[model samples]
Target: MIIEIKIPTPGESITEVELGKWLVDDGSIVSKNEEVAEIESDKATLTLVAPETGKISFKVEEGVTVAVGELACTIDTDAAGEVALDPPVAAQPKAEPETIKTEASTEKTSSADQRRIKTTAVAREIMEEHHLSVDDIIQGLQRIGKKEVEAVINQPTSTQKMESAPKNLFSRDESREKMSMLRRKLSQRLVAVKNETAMLTTFNEVDMSPIMEIRKQFQNKFIEKHGLKLGFMSFFTKAVATAMQFHPAINSMIDGEEILTPQFVDVGIAVQTPKGLMVPIVRNAESKSIPAIELEIKELAEKARSKKISVEELTGGTFTITNGGTFGSLLSTPIINPPQSAILGMHNIVDRPMAVDGQVVIRPMMYLALSYDHRIIDGKDSVGFLVKVKSLLEKPQLLLTDGKLPEELLLEL
Candidate 1:
C-alpha cells in the first residue's frame, strides 16, 4: 500500500517549513524511525522519520517550502525495493570516464554558454591581468570546467601566482549550492534575538579555586559511586536556583504590561548538538541533587546530539545557562532565550595572576556573563543573581552542607 508521508506541524505557532534535503535516495528502502528528510523551521531543524519500514519515493524537491500537513513524500510498504541501474538505451554516444578529456588539449576551447568568471575582485583582476580564461585555469588545475572550478579560478592568489599567471586551484566547471535552509533560519533567529529584546550584558569574574578543590577532593569518589563525572554544571545550576529564590525577577518574563514570574525554576542547559543548539530543561532544578543534575544533563546532552529531544524538552524554560567555554570562547554576551528574562554565559577557565593574600599568585578564574531583558529585570537583580551564583561556586562547601541529597531531589534515582 502507498503510504502518504505528510509534513508534521513543527510547532504550535509555526505552520510551514522548508524541506531542507532528503537523506535517503528515491527508491531506497528505509527503516522505521530512520530519518528520511530534514525540515527546517524557524525555531529548529527537524528530521522527518519513516513511519514504517518501506521503499521510499520523493514527492517534493529539496529547498521547497511546504505547509503543515502537506504530502512531503510517499512510502510503499508492500512494494519491493527496486532501483533502475541501467542508463537509457537510446543514448547516442558512450562517454567513458577515461574518454572524458578536455578539448583544451591542442585545441582552442570555447563555450557559447557565456561563462563569466565569478571570483573575488582581486582574483578577477589578477586573472584578467594574466589574460587567462577560466578554461586555461581549469586545464592547468586538471579539473573540468565547473562553477567551483570557476571559484577556484576566482580564489585569492599570492603574488607568485599573479606573476606566474599559469596555475589554477581546481576545475572551474562546477556549480555551487545555496546555503542550507536551517542555516538561513538560524541566522534569522540569532538576529531577531539581538534586535527584538532590550538586551544588556553584565560581566563578573569568579575564582575557580573552590570548585577545583572540591572536584579534586571528591571527583574520583563521586564518579565511582554514580558512574558519572562530577562537573561544574550541577554547582552552577544549584547556584542559579538559589539566586532565583532571592532575586525572582531573573526568572521572570515581561509580557507587555504584566510581569510573569515562574514559581519553579526550569533551568535550560544549552547543549550544542550536531543538529544545532538545543536547550533542554532541568525541571525543578531547585530540588535536584548534584548527581541527579549531572545524570539529567548527560541524558539531555545525549538526546540533544542524537536529535531525540522532544518538542516539550525545548519549551517553557524559565532561565538558561550556556557555556561557550566548552568551545574555548573566552567571553560572550549570550542573548536571552525568548520568553526567558535572562541567560547566564560561562567562559573558559585559565590560571591567571591575581592578588590573593599579599603576593600575586596564579589561580584559575573564569568570566561569567549574564544577559537579561532590561525591561523586566533591574540591573541590581541581574547582577545580584550572577553574584549569588559566583559565590556558591566559589564556596561549594556551603552548598554541599545545605543542599538536598539525591533521595530528596530526584525520586527516580
Candidate 2:
C-alpha cells in the first residue's frame, strides 16, 4: 500500500509553506516517522517526516509554495529496502599486504583532457618574460595567472615527456544555495520596518558594577534558591517591564492611524537560532517573578532554537529586547520590531574608567540603545524609558532583591 504524505497546517495565519529540501532521495526506503524533508514557513522551519516505513517519492519540488494539507510526497509501504554493494572481483592469491596495489585507474596520466585557460594581462606579461607558449599554461589553469605562467616555465618542453604527463587545471570549488522561506520572510519584514517606520535610536551607557557585584556575591545562592542560573535577561525584562509602565508610548503600537496600548507588558526576547532571529513573547511579563521570567525565557529560547515554538508565542509583543552582547558586539543600532514601537539593544560589558564621587575609577559598563518608532513615541519618552531601565538595571536590588518594587520607582501612568 502506498501512503500519502501531506503538509500539516503549521498555523492559522500560515496558509502555505515552502518545501525547503528533501533529505531523502526518491525511491529511498525510510522508516516510520523518520524525517524525510524540511518545511519552511513564514514563522519557522518544520520537519516533514515519513508517515510509514517505505520507499518515498516526492510529489512536489523544493522551494515550491503549497497550501496547507496539500500533497507533499508519497511512500510505498510494501516496498522492501534495497541494499547496494559493489561488484566483486577475483582476489590475488599469496600476495603480501604491503606489496599489493588495490587497483589501477582506467583514465591514466596520458588520457587526461587538457583544460582551456583564459589569460589575464598579468599572465601575458609573465608569459612574455618566461618565453612560453599559451598552450604551456592552458592545461593547468582555467584562468591564467602569474603562478600558472611560472608553473609552465618550470616544466620540460619535450613533447614526449609532456605527453607522458597529463596536467590538471586548478579548479575553484564553490556552492550555490537557495534562501529559506523563513529567511525571505525575515528580509521582507526587516525591509518593511525600515521603510514604513519613522525610526530613531537613543543611546546610553550604564555602570554594570552593581549588578555584577550582586551576581558574583549571590549567584550560587540565587541558583540554589531558584534552580536557575542568574542571568541579565531577567533583570532587563524586569527593568523594561517597570520602565514601560512609566512610558506608555514605548509599549504602544500604531495601527492605521490608531494608537493601540495594552494594559499588560508582553516582552519579546530576540533569540538567535539556526533558523533565524525569532522574537518569542513572555506574556504578562510585568507580573511574573524574576525566577519565573528566567525559566520561561529559557524554555522559549530553547523552543525557538529547536523550531518547536508555536506561532502564537512568536506574536503579539509589546516591546522587544535584543542582546548583541552575547556575540561580543560593543554597540549596534537595533531596528524596532513592528507593531511594537520600541526595541532595546544590549551590548557587551567592559571595564572602563568612570567618574565616582568626583574621582575616576574603573567600572564595568555596558551601552544601551533604544530604537523606537518616532511617529508615535517622542524623543523625551524614549530617552526617559531607557533611563528608567538603566537605573533599574544599575540598582536591581530595588526590584529583584525581594520581588518588591519600591513605590518611588513606579511612575503614575
Candidate 3:
C-alpha cells in the first residue's frame, strides 16, 4: 500500500534537480494529487504531487540535488487514517465574555500604537504571561511620574542612535548557499550571450499620456467585460507584436549559420520569481486582442511565480519583453534571451517637459531599450523596430490595425 514517489524530469536536458522545499511535514496525511514538494531544475521549478491519499514520509532532504527519477518520498496509503486530527472546538473550554472582550479590544488597538510602544524583554514576557498588551498595561498604570518624563527626555534620538551605533556589528558575519541549478544555468547563459553574440542596444522614448488616458477612461469597462484590469504590459506587448509585422527581422533568430524567422510571434514575458527569472511565452501575441494578452500574461506570470508553470510554457519564444519599470528602473539595456534576436526593455515613466507644437508641455514619458544581435539584425532594423513600437504604444489604437492607421489599412496604402 506504500507508493514510492520519484523526482519528475523538468525537461529533456535536465538530468538532476535540487529539492526546493516540502509543502507538508513528514508523516502528515496528504490528499491524492496534492502537491507535496517542489523540485528546482535549471529551466523551471516543478512540483511533486501525491499519487494517492496517504501519510507521506520524506526520503531526501530539501536543497539536496537528486537525479531525475530518483526516489524522493513514499506515501503509505494504508496509513491515511493513522494521523491524528485536532479535537472539535466544542471539546475545548470556551473563553469567558470578559476575557474575549479584552482580547478583542487588544486586537482593535491602532497599529501605530502597537508599533510605537517599546518594551523590555522581561516586561514583554510578563505581559504575554497575563495575555496583556502595551495598551492594557498603559490602562492599568496609576500615574506617570517625574522619573518617567525624565526617561522620555533622556531617550536617544534616532539620529543620535545611528551615530553612536557600532559600524561593524554583525558586518563581519558571512554565509554562503549553493546556487540553485536555475541560477547557475542563468549565469552561464548570460556569459554565453555576451561572448557569443554581437549584441547592440538602441533606445527610444514614448509619450505615455495617450495610453494612460485610455486606461483611466476604459479600465472599469475593460475589467467589467474581461474580469481583469487594463495594464501597461498588455499595451506594450500588443505594440511589440504589431510592430514586428513592420520589422520582421527583429523577431528572427540566428540558428547555426541559418537565420530562422518564425511566422508566428510568441512573446516571452520575463517574470521575476523568488527562485529566479522565468520567461513564460504568450503564444502568437500578434493575433490576440489586448484583453486576451492581459489574461494570458496574468496566468503565465502567476504560474511562474508560484512555480507551477511547465517547461513548455517557458520555451519556444521568438522574442522577449522585460519591464524594469515595475521596479523603478529609469533605463537599462536588457540582454537578449537566447535564440531570440531581440528583447524590448521598458523602464520607469517620468513626467518631463516636452516640445509640442512649438510649446513646452509636461508629459509622462517612458524609455524603451531594444537589444539585438547585430550580426543578424542591422542598426536600421533595430532602430526602425523600436521606433515602430514607440509609435504603436503612443497611439495604442494603431495596435488594432497591426501598427497601421485605420485609414491607412482602409485605403490599402
Candidate 4:
C-alpha cells in the first residue's frame, strides 16, 4: 500500500508551508512516528512524519511552498525496504520542502549545474573555519549523474593560487543551483528586520553576583523538583518584564502613526534549531514564575528542535531576547524583531577583575545590549530599561518580595 503524506495544518489560517528539510533521503524507510521532513509555516517549523511504516517518496522539490493538505510526499507502505525516488521525468513531490541542501548550492555554485549543495548560513562559517576557497569546497557539492560546471574565476585567481592551497584540495567542475524556498524567505525576513526598523543598539555591563548566589543556593533543589537546571534565562526574562513595566514603550509596537502599547508581555526567546533560528513566545511572561517560565522555555525549545512548535506559538511576540552567550558571543548588537520596539541581547558571562567600592576584585560580568526603534523608544528609555534589568539581575530578591512568585512555588505537598 502507498501512503500519501500531506502537509499537516500548522495552525488556523495558515494556508501554506515552506519545505524546510528532508531528514530522510528519498529512499529511506521510516517508522510511523519518525520525522521525515520539516515544513515551515508562517509561524513555526513543523515536522512532517510518516503516517505509517513505509518507504518515503518525494512529491516536490526543496524550496517550493505548498498549500496545507497538499501532497508533500508519498510512502510505499508495501515496499519491503527503502524506495529510491525517480529523479525528474517521473513525478513531483508536494510543494518542495525548504531544502537547506538547495540553498547551500545556490550560494556556492553556479546555475549551469543543477545538482549542488546549497551552502547555508552555517556552511559559509564551516568554509571559513577550514580556510577553504571556493575551489577547495566545490568538489564536495556534486550529486551523481548531474552536469558539473567549473566555478568561474571572477577574482584574482593567480594571487589566490599562489597563496599555497592545502594538500588534496583542488578545483573541481560544479554547476550552480537555485536557492531553497526557506533560504530565500529566511534571507528576506532577516533583511526586512534590518531595513524596516529605525535600528540602533545600546550596550551595558551587568554584574552577576546576586543571581549567581541565588542560583548556587537553589539550583540543586530546583532541578531536583523540575528535572531541569536553574538557568539564567528565567531570571533574565523576569528582569526584562520588570524593566518593561517601567518603560512600556519598549513592549509596544508602531502601527503606522500610532504607538500601540501592549498590556501584557509576550516575550520571544530565540532558540537555535536544526533548521534555523526559531523564536518561540512565552505568553503573559510577567505573570509566570521563574520555574514556570523555565519550564515553558524548555518546552518551547524542545519543540522547536523537534519541529513541533505551532504557528500561533511562534507569532504575536511583543519583544525578543536572544542569548548570544550560548554560542560564546562576548557582545553583539542584535537586530530588533520588527514591530516590537526592542530586543535584548545577552552575552557570555566572564569572571574578570573589576573595581568594587574602590577596591579591585574579580566578579562575574556579562554584557547586555538592547536594540530598539529610535522612533518610539528614546535612547534614555532604552538605556534605562537595560539598566533596570541589570539592577533586578544584580538583586533578584526585589521581584521575589514583590509578589512576582507564583502560588505554586509555595507548595510543599
Candidate 5:
C-alpha cells in the first residue's frame, strides 16, 4: 500500500508553501508520524511527517513552491521490513596486533627533533659543507656550557619571520540564494510597518542590580521548585504586563481608524530561529506568575527553533517584547509588530557609575526602548509606560502589586 503525504496548511489564508528541505533520503524507510521534510510558509516553518511506516519517495523537490494540500511525497508501506541488516559479529574479520619498528621510530623521532632546533645561516652552510645534519651536531656536543646557552637564547625564534611574503590575500567570491517564505513576508511586514504607521520610539534606563541580586539570591531555590532557571525575559514580560495597567494606550491598536484596546495582555516574546525571527505569544501574560511565564517561554522558544510550533501559537499578541541584549546590542529601537501598538526593546546591561542620593555608585544598568504607533499612543503615554516598566524592573517587588507599592495597594490608593 502507498500512502500520500501532502503539504499541510500553515494557516487559514495560506494557499502555498515552499518545500524547505528533505529530512530523509529518498526511498529510505520511515516510521509512522516521523518527520521527513520541512515546509516553509510566510508565517512559520512546519514539518511533513510520514502517514505510515514505509519507504518514502519525494513527489516535489526541495526549495520549490507548491500549493497547499499538494502531494509532497508518497510512502510504500509494502516496502517495509526490506531494509538489510548488519552481518553477524562471528563472520566479521578479527583484529591483528600492530608491531613497532624501533630503528624506524628512533630515526623519525630524531628527524622531528632536528627540524625543531633553530640553526643560524652560517651554521647551516658549515653543516651542508661537512655533509652533516642537526642531529649529528647535537650528538657531537658532549657538554653543556654558558656559551651554548647564550647561543641557544640568541637563535631566531621562527623560520617564517625570516622569510618575506605578501600579506594581501583574500577571496572576492559571492553567492545568492532564494529567500524563504518567512523572510520575504518579514520584509513586506517590516516595510508596511514603516510606511503605514506613525511609529515613534521612547527610551529609558533601568538599574539591573536589583533584579540581578534577586536572581543570584533565589535562583537555586527557584530552579529547585520550578525545574527551570529564572531568566531576565520573564521579569521584563511580567513588568510590561503590570505596567500596561498604568498605561493602557501602549497596549491598544488601531483598527480601521478606531483605536481598539483589549482588556487582556498577551505579550509576544520575539524568538530568533535559524529559519527567521518568530514571535510566539504568551496569552494572558498579565495573569501569569513569573515561574509560569518562564516555563511557557522556554517551551514556546524550543518549539519555534525546532520548527514544531503551530501557527496559532504565533498569532493574537497584543504587545511584543524583543531582547536585543541576548545579541550584545547596547541599544535598539524595536519596530512594532503589526496590529499591535508597541514593542519593548531590552539591551545589554553594563556596570556604570550612577548618582544615587548624595554619592555616585556603580550600578548594572540596561537601556529600554518602547516603540509605539504615534497615531494612537501619545508621547506622554509612551514615555510614562517605559518609565513604569523601568520602575517595576528596578523594584521587582512592585510587580506583585501591579507596579505599585504594597503599602499603596493595601491602603487602596
Candidate 6:
C-alpha cells in the first residue's frame, strides 16, 4: 500500500509552510519515523518524518510553499525491499548523516572536468541553503549519465578570487539568490518597528570593574558549581530585572493606544544562528539567580542555534538584550525587537583612562545602548532606568545578591 505523506499542521495560525528541504534522497528506503524533510512555518522549522519504512518520493519540491494537509510526498510500503534500478542510479551503501555536514575547505579534483552527483530536487535545495559545495559532499559518487545543470551549483574555478585579477572585462562579480521567508519576515519586522515606533537610542558607559572583579575572583569556583562560564549576560540580565521595578516603562510597550506593563520580567536574549537572528525569552528572569539565568540562557541559545527552539519560547518578551561585544564590536545602536519597547545593546569592554574621585585612573569600560520606543518611554525614565542598570552592574555584588552581598545569593530583605 502507498502511504501519502501530507504536511502536518505546525499551528492553528500557520496555514501554509515552506517546503524547506528533503533530508533523505528521493527513492531511498526510510525507516519508520525517520526525518525525511524540513517544513518551515512563519514561526518555526519542523521536521517532516517518514510515516513508515518504505521508498519515498517527493510530490513537491523544496523552497515552495504548500498548504497544511497538502501532499508533500508518498511512501510505497512494499518498495523498500524490492526496488531496483540501473547501476549507479540505484541505492548505494547508506552514508552516516554526520558525514553530510558541509565543510568550508572543499576538496578539489585535479581534472578540469566537473562531476555531477545524483540528488533529489529537494536535496539540491538543502545543499544550497547549507552553503555546501558539491565537492564537500560528493564522496565516491558513481556517475553514468549525461551531466546537466538541473540543480548543479558551479564547481570552484581556478581564476583569481582575490585582488580583482587586474580588472578584466568579463568579470563575474555578483550573483542573486531569493530571500527565504524567515529573512523576509525579519526584514518586514525591522522596517515595521522603525516606521511605526517613535524609537530613540540612549548611550551610556558602564564601569565593568565590579563585574570583572567578581568573575575573575570566582571564575573557577563559579564554573565548577554552575558547570558554565561566568558570562556578562547574567549580570546585565539581573541589572535589567532589578531596574525595571523602578522604571517599568523601559520594559513596557504601547499596544495600540494602551501601554501594557508586564509585572514579570521575561528578558529576550538575542541569539544569532545559521538561519537568522532569533530572540528566545528567558522566562521570569527577575526571580531567577545568576546561576539559573546562565543555565537557562545557555539552553535557550543552544536550542535556537539548533532550530529546536519552540515558537512559544521565541515569542512574548518584555525586553531584549543584544551583545555585539561577542563579535568584537566596540559600540553599536541595536534596534528594538517588535512589541517590546526597548532593547539593550552590550559592547566590548575597553580599558580606558578615567577620573576616579580625586585621582585619574584606568577602568575597563563598556558602552551600553538602550533603544526605546519614545511613545512609551520618556527621556527621564529612560535615562534613570539606564542609570539603575549601570549602578547594579557596577556593583554586581548588590545586583547578584540584591542590596547586600550575602554569604549566599539570597536577598537580605
- CA lDDT of every candidate: 0.76, 0.80, 0.83, 0.76, 0.84, 0.78
Lowest summed lDDT window (length 10), candidate 6: 142-151
| Better by TM-score, candidate 5 or 4 | 5
lDDT of candidate 4 vs native?
0.76
Q: What TM-score quantifies how close candidate 5 is to the native fold?
A: 0.81
TM-score of candidate 2 on Cα atoms, chains taken together: 0.73
lDDT of 3 by residue, 1-48 (tens): 999999988887778899988977677667787788989988888889
Per-residue lDDT for 1-413 in model 2, tens only?
A: 98898998888889999998887667666667777888888888878877777777899998899988999999887773342111122321223222212367233221122213344445556755765545555645544555567776777658868677565678687899888888888999999999999999999999988888878999999989989788989889988998877788899998887999998999999999887889999999889988899999999999888767887888888999999999999999999888789999999999999989999999989999999999999999999989888888888876653233566446431
Query: What would the TM-scores of all predictions be?
Result: 0.71, 0.73, 0.81, 0.72, 0.81, 0.75
Mark the regions of model 6 whose C-alpha exceeds 4 Å error after superposition: 1-4, 31-34, 51-53, 77-170, 400-413
Per-residue lDDT of 213-288 in model 1, one digit per residue for the tens? 8889999999899998889888898888877877999989978789999799999999886556778899999888
Summed backbone clashes in each candidate are: 9, 0, 0, 22, 0, 0
The segments of candidate 3 whose C-alpha lies over 4 angstroms from its true place after superposition are 29-34, 93-170
Over the stretch 1-413, how does candidate 4's per-residue lDDT look in tens digits? Answer: 98788888888888888886787668555666767787876556778877787767899778788888999889888773433322242332243323225545654332223223333223334444544433454545522111112223233477687996666766686999655444566778779988777889999999998888888998899989999998999998888887787788899998979889988999999998756678999999988899999999999999888777887888889999999999999999998887688999999999999998999999999999999989888988998888888878887886774423445456731
Which ranges in model 4 have alpha carbons more than 4 Å from their true place? 25-29, 55-57, 76-166, 169-180, 402-413
Q: What tens-digit string does per-residue lDDT give for candidate 6 at 1-413?
A: 89999998776677898988887767766667777887776766767878787888899998999999999999998886553222142232233223222387554441211124444334444554655444445455532111222234454445634534565668768999766667778989999988998989899999999888888999999999889999899889989998898898888887778889989999999998766788889989889999999999999999887666777888789999999999999989899998999999999999999998989899999999999989879999999989888988887767745544465445434
lDDT of 5 by residue, 136-166 (tens): 5554442222334445545655785567575
Ranking by lDDT: 5, 3, 2, 6, 1, 4
**Candidate 1 TM-score versus the reference:** 0.71
Error of 6 at 205 (Å): 1.0
**Model 6 steric clash pairs:** none
Best lDDT among the predictions, by candidate number: 5
Candidate 1 vs candidate 5, TM-score winner = 5
